[model samples]
Target chain A: MSAVEKASRPRVAIVNFGMGNLFSVRQACLRAGLEPSITSKKAELLEADGVILPGVGAFGRAMETLREQGLVSVLKDLAAAGRPFMGICLGLQLLFDESIEFGRHEGMAIFAGQVVRLEPGIGPAGRPLKIPEIGWKPLRPPSGRGWDGSLLEGLPEGAHMYFVHSFHALAAKSESVLAITPFGDMNYCAAVQQGRLFACQFHPERSGPVGLKVYENFRKMILSGR
Target chain B: MAAVRFIARLDVKGPNLVKGVHLEGLRVLGKPEDFARHYYENGIDELIFMDVVASLYGRNSLLDIIRKTSSEIFIPLSVGGGLRSIEDIRAVLAAGADKVCLNTAAIANPELVREASRCFGSSTIVVSIEAIRQPDGSYEAYTDNGRQKTGVEAVGWARRAAELGAGEIMITSVDREGTGQGYDLALTKSVASAVDIPVIACGGAGRKEHVGDAVTQGWANAVGVASLLHYNVLDVVGGTGSYEEEGNIEYLKGRRGFSHVERSSLGEIKEYLRGLGLECR
Candidate 1:
């Protein structure tokens, strides 16, 4: 823990658009052996060895805050430049073309998809499934795709993840959909991987030991410089 | 259907984690973080830390505990008790609490539920409803950890809180709490059926069968267990590591166990629930 050693560690910039708490994300990064900084400055974001977009809240409000902070294009360029990017929860929604939450709002458009609210459906017991889908769910790889060599590498097939959101993304292209999770009667995109950009609709930082592997993987990806 | 969340509830008084029958006459168990880490490692779905004496002191003292656990534990951490204002909520969230449970403040000013939800997303706001069943079979809302009674109806308050944008509701039965008998199924069902948001049933889980009843009969989306899990850990941990200058330490020093409530670990509870064909992580 010398200052020199601390500076030598990989820098992970967590985009702070002033929407939600970033403490858990920052703590997860440190536990994963990465030096994390919560910054919105374009230069700080671009200079980091890895970047994480962690958020919670309404999609339209988050986008508005990002735009107001002048971080819209900055995020797009970072994902476009392939800077080991990862998004969690609402951050995953902001990577799409647009979201219909609280009216249609533009997104960072790094991926081709539209975020829509989860359809209300009834559970097996005849009770209506709760909105926001607040609970732990296991991840299933999409057909023709695997977790191997991806952001979810080394994770088990049915690894449970913590999710808390009312809306999910609809990937236009099938190849972009990395994982799909089943609700009452619908299946929605849980995670997406296109080139260097990666995003998941679950909070890995809040998902426990199994979820911590995700941050560990991101740290390894940064150190490997791939 | 998604898996049912099995959460461990820890009632903290000063620096010690304590448990009491009817949320009174608390007996110090041990350190809060130790039990939290143990539960997290054992695959507990979530952890809730309630400051049992925060209302009496007029401030939440769980900030340090929350910060310490947020670094070591990698799961959702929710802190409650004496969160009166927006700044208090912000302070706890910034200290690494994923959600804040509001009871006294929300009951005093119902608008806090709406305002806090709007300010910090609905998902971050959880309305804690403590209820005591009346002679007429209607449940009344109680504040200050079931010490003060409000004339408001329990089920009606739940509907109102959800309408005010609360993403989740945690209904704790003051009568059933710490009794180790079972959850007040009537109280939970009425509230759960009233709101579309998730409702977590708290208190009165003596055995794994009680947990099953809470989900199957009570219709609880999640269960907040304290005595069953806490006593189980205490049996293994045996004696408090350090005597903190707060709360009652005599219970821990004597190593006297609670014979009334059956003890079970988080793993055993999840296994029993899964055996009954209920999905659990």
Candidate 2:
């Protein structure tokens, strides 16, 4: 595509799971100057220049909906095809192997991991500090990543992002971790990037300007086909 | 300065972070760690995680998210959703949450507020009231994500929440939610007037000026919005649409809402206050 055509906006799809933050995701995409479409249709998802899977509810329900929609295989196929696929919150967790929230439920299994609770024994003792950790915390990106990727570009390392969730990914391999945040005695991975798939455990849309940069960077990658 | 208190809200279901209106707008933002770090870096004063689906799920996942976030953020965190008894409150607090918010559970068992305050102190207890404007022009309290009407008056609930030892009352208007129309000033003022403790006005914010309005006109301590800020609709981009445009971008900018203007004014006031060798507070 020529520069003029390259400047043409890409059609982005923000996957709707019937239980996620579609507005915020859609709004963020629009602010990034990308025309965003919300859909659960597999064909629409596969047709997009890039796909964003955003969720904010239960793990099992999200999985069930994805399975019902038959999106599980398409998303995995898209990722395997090196198409840029991003997952936010539950969307990210759903990329894991499974979750132990209420019971064992299979995930997309795109990444090698399981979603597990942040056990109380690992943190400060007053009470078992509430589950679903909310608010902002600092993010430490992986060393020497050079901040040039589709995500975390134009954003400084150690920048904080908004988060609200009860469980986190227990990655089967440590290399999948793109960033880490210190919580109590444990340091948990914040962003995980494996191949063309990018997943974050925080709400970039809600993280203000610094967070907006992440979305913009993602848009740039989608446009550049990088 | 009172540190301009900030409260972070985490709406969750099962193990995922969910956002929506009356359980819509469903999309996950990010992982618990990403959100926690972002808010901490942005200088949030306090954080709140409400499991919008907790009651239906019969479990509070805010505790798990809180424990993970608190370990990373090192800021005050509050957890809510499906919180029914003192044990639930205790479990959340122990998980690293500094406060616990009560909605349906507190309404069902008003004594839970008192019990929570006794064990965790009033400062750590918050009462969240979801209100929707009725066709009669009065606001009715709703429970279960506005699914059930309680016929409880908004003002009455504010007073009751305070009396029941709630340190703060968070009032969210369903009608104005995600609309960016500006907060319901009249309703906010009534609730603020009814309670001595801090009152947070949530919903219908599209700009920084809305924050000031919520604080000044609504007499609220804070304002909450998920759409405008989350979407970057704010005029962070300083530009008037080009000469090709019919009018100046400045006019188009302010048309979104007045809260942005109010916030800018507040910033100026704070700066002026500093220059005058006086505290903004």
Q: Write the per-residue lDDT of candidate 1 for residues B151-270, one digit (tens) a residue.
A: 999999999999999999999999989999999998998998899899999989998899998888888889999998888888665354776677777877777768767888777888
lDDT, residue B232, model 1: 83
Superposed on all Cα atoms, the candidates' RMSDs to the truth, in angstroms, are 1.8, 15.4
> Candidate 2: what lDDT?
0.68
Give the best candidate by TM-score.
1
Q: Which CAPRI tier for candidate 2?
A: incorrect
Q: For candidate 2, what is the DockQ?
A: 0.02
DockQ metric for all predictions: 0.82, 0.02
Candidates' chain B TM-scores in the order shown = 0.96, 0.78
